[model samples]
Target: MTDTDLDQSYSAVCEALAQVGEARAPMLLAMLCLSLMSRFERADQVLPLIANALAQSDEGDADGR
Candidate 1:
C-alpha cells in the first residue's frame, strides 16, 4: 500500500481503538493481534516482531522518543 493508505489505515485503527475505550482496548487489541497472527504461514515468527514493536513503544514512552 502507499504511504497515504498506510497513514489512513493506522488512523482508522486508532479511532476504532478509541471507540473501544481504555477499559476494553487491551482485550480488543489482543484479539486483533491473534486474528492477524493466525493469517501468517509462520505465526511463531511474528511474535518477535510484536515483542520488538512493543519494546519500541515502551522505550518511546520512557525516553519521549
Candidate 2:
C-alpha cells in the first residue's frame, strides 16, 4: 500500500480504538504493528512502530504498576 493508504489505515484504526475507549486500547497496539508491517514495504516504516512500542513499554515500566 502507499503511504497515503497507510495513513488512512492508521487513522481508521485510531478512530476505532477511540470509539472502543481506553479498556481496549492496549490490544490495538498489536493491530498497529501488523497493519504497519503489512502496509509498509520500506524498512523505515518498521522503525516507527518499534520505537512507539519501546516508548510505551518504557512508560509502563516507569509507572511501576
Candidate 3:
C-alpha cells in the first residue's frame, strides 16, 4: 500500500483502538480481517458497521428472555 493508504489504515486502527479501549494489535488484526471479508460484501470497508452489528447482537442476546 502507498503511504497515504498506510496512513489511512493506521488512523483507522488508532480510532478503533480508542473507541474499543483495547490493545492496538487486536483491533488492527480485526480491521484486516474485516477488510478482507469486505471484499465479498461492502461492509468490510468500515469497522464501525461491523461493531454496530456486534453490539446489536449483544443487545438482542440480553433481551432474548
What TM-score number comes out for model 2?
A: 0.45
Please give the range of 10 consecutive residues that has the lowest summed lDDT in model 3: 38-47
Residue 48 CA displacement from its true place in model 3, Å: 30
lDDT of 1 at 46: 96
Question: Which lDDT values do the candidates have, in the order given?
Answer: 0.90, 0.83, 0.75
Error of 2 at 47 (Å): 11
Q: What is the lDDT of candidate 2?
A: 0.83
Models sorted by TM-score, best on top: 1, 2, 3
Select the stronger candidate by TM-score from 2 and 3: 2
Error of 3 at 36 (Å): 6.1
In model 1, the Cα lDDT at residue 11 comes to 93
- lDDT per residue, candidate 3, 3-55, as tens digits? 99999988987777777676566866777776677676544555676798789
- Runs in model 3 with CA error above 4 Å? 23-65
Best prediction by TM-score = 1
Q: How do all models score by TM-score?
A: 0.74, 0.45, 0.37
Question: Per-residue lDDT for 1-65 in model 1, tens only?
Answer: 89999999899889989999999999988998898788888957898988999899999999977
Error of 1 at 32 (Å): 1.1
